[model samples]
Target: MEFFADIADVAQVKEMQEWLPLDGVTTNPTIVARAKKELFTLIEELLAACEGIVQVQTLAYSTEEIVAEAKRLVAVEPSRIIPKIPCTQAGLGAVMRLSKEGLRTTVTGLITVPQGLFAARAGATYVAPYINWVDSMEWSGTEVVAELLAAFEAYGLDTKVIAASVKTARQFRELASLGTNAVTMPPETYKTILEHPLTDKALRNFADNWNGVFQEYKLDSKLKG
Candidate 1:
C-alpha cells in the first residue's frame, strides 16, 4: 500500500521525506490555512519537496468553478498535481468533466459505499473516505472501507481508494489489512505506527550485549588485525 502525508508544512514534509517511504502529500483548506502561507507559494514548495504527486483540494463549490479552479491548480505541474474535489453532485460533475479531459482527480469527503460507487462511475482517479469522521458519527469506518473495497472489486473498477482522516495506528493497520490502495495521515501518526516498546527494548538489549563483548573494539577494527 502507498503512504501519503496529510500535511502542509514544508519543513515537516521534508523531514518525513528523509526518513519515511512517502508516496505523496495531501492538502486541504484547513491544512493550508495552518501553514500561514499563500496557497500557490506553498504548493510550489511542496512540489519541490515531495517526490510524488501532491493532492490539492478545490475551494470552489459549483461544478463550473470547481473545474476552472482544478485547471488552474493542475497548470502548476500537470504530472504531479491532483485536484481533490468533494463528494457532492457538483463535485461529481466536475470530476467527470476533468476525467474526460485526461486530468487525474481525487474525490474527497467520502463516507458511504454509494458515494464511492458514484465517484468511480464518474471516472475519479481516486476516492478518499474520511475514516475517523465516520467513526465519530457512530459508524464503523473500517467496515465502510472494507465494503468499498469489496464493491470496487465486484465491479472491477480501477478507481483506487485512498483512506483519509486516519488518526490512530490501529486505524491505519485496519485500513492496510483491508487492502486500501493508499492512506493519508499526519506525520506523528506515521511515527506512532512504526514504533513499539518491544522493538525498542530488543534494540537496547542488542546494544548492551555488543558492548559487553566488544568493549572499545569495533567490528571492523577487530577484523583488521
Candidate 2:
C-alpha cells in the first residue's frame, strides 16, 4: 500500500511529499540524467528532501562491480538508501551479497513470476515489475502482478512487489485492488489518480449551496461565537 514517487527532481519530490502520502522515491539512470546534476549530489539532495527510503540504481553489470557500486551508494546514507539492481544473474548475486551485509536492495526490470521468485530467494527487499512493458507484449500486466502476489504469499516470502511503469489511473486502481505491496509512479500519474471530474463537480455544488445559505457567514466565526 506504499506510494513512491518515481522521480529524480528534488523540487518535485518535495512537492509530492507535501501533497501526497509518499513513502519514498525511486530513480533510474534515465531519471537521474534528466535531472542534469551530479549523481551523488542529486542523490544527496533527494535523500535530504525525502522522508523515507530512496532507491538508487546501480550501473554495474557484473556481480563484483554491482556489489561494489551498491556498497558505495549505501555508504552515502546507510539507513535510507536502497540499491536498485537489475533482474540478472549478476544482479541477483550482488543482491544476495549485499543483503547478507544487512543492506536492503530492490530488484528491478522484473516481468515474470519466476523472475520475481528468484529475486525474493536472493534476498531482495522489493521486486519491481514493469506493468506497461508487460501489457505492450500482448499480455496482462495486472495478471502478472496478481500472479506474483499469489506466489509470494504462497511461498511466505518477505520480498514485496512494487509495481512500476504505471501509465493510467485505471491501471493504478487495478494494481491497488490486487493489494500489491507498493507502487511507484510518475508525479503526473499520481495527480491523475487523485483527481476526478465528479469529485470536482460535487465540491462546486457544495460551495454554491453553502454560499447561498451562509451569505458570507464564515464557519470559523460561528465556531468562535
Candidate 3:
C-alpha cells in the first residue's frame, strides 16, 4: 500500500518528506486555494520537494477544458504529475482520452460502485473513493471499496483503488487491512498514525535503561583515525 499527503501547504509537504515515507501528494482546487500561492508554481514546488507523483485535480467542467487543463498541469512536470479527473461523465471521457495519450490519470470524487466501474473503464490509473464521506451518509465506504476491488479483479481491470477522505487512524488501518492499494489523507491523519503514547513510553524506557547501563563508561573526547 502507498500513503499520499492530502495537502498543498509547502511546510506540511516538507514535513511529510522529512518524516513520512509518502508516495505522493494529492491536491484539489480547494486545497490549492488554501495555500494562497500561484497554482502551478505551488504544485511545481511540491513536485520538486517530494520527487513523486503529484495528483492535481482539474477545475474545468467540460471534457475539452478538462483535457486542456490536464495537459497544462502535466506540462509543469510530465513524469510526476497525475491529473485527477472527477468521476463524472465528462471527467471519465477526459480520463479515457488522456490515458490513450500516454498520460496517467486518477479519477477522484468517487463514492459508489458505478463511479468506480466507470473510472476503471476509463483507464484511470487510480480510482479514489471518498470513504469517510460515504460513511457520513450512513453508508459503508469500505464495502464500496471491497465491491470495487472485487469488480476490478473479476473483470481484470488494472486500476488501483485509493481510499481517500480518511479521517481517522482506525479507518486508515481498516482500509489497509482490506487490501487497499493506496490512501491519501490529511497531514494530521498521517501524524496520528505515526504516533502513540505507548510507543513513546516504550522508547523512553529503552533509552533510560540503555543510559543507565552505560552511565559509568565514557568515550575519549578526541577522535583519532
All candidates' lDDT scores?
Answer: 0.92, 0.92, 0.89
Q: Which 10 consecutive residues of model 2 have the lowest summed lDDT?
A: 216-225
Sorted by lDDT (best first), the order is 1, 2, 3
For candidate 1, write residues 1-225 as lDDT tens digits: 988999998899999988988889999999999999999999999999988999999999899999999999999999999999999999999999999999999999999989999999999999999999999999988998999999989999999999999988788889988889999998998889899999999998987777666644466524222
Residue 73, model 3: lDDT of 91
Q: Give the TM-score of candidate 2.
A: 0.94
lDDT of 3 by residue, 1-225 (tens): 998999998788888778778899999989999889998789878988787789999999999999999999999888899999998889999998998998889999999999999899889999999999999999988899989999999999999999999988778778888899999988898888889999999988976765665653245223222
Task: Report backbone clashes per prediction.
Answer: 0, 0, 0
Ranking the candidates on TM-score from highest down gives 1, 2, 3
Instruction: List clashing residue pairs in candidate 1.
Output: none
What is the C-alpha lDDT profile of model 2 across 1-225, one tens digit per residue?
999999998888999888888899999999999999999999899988988989999999999999999999999999899999999999999999998988899999998889999999999999999999999999888899999989889999899999999998878889989999999998989998899999999998987777776655467433222
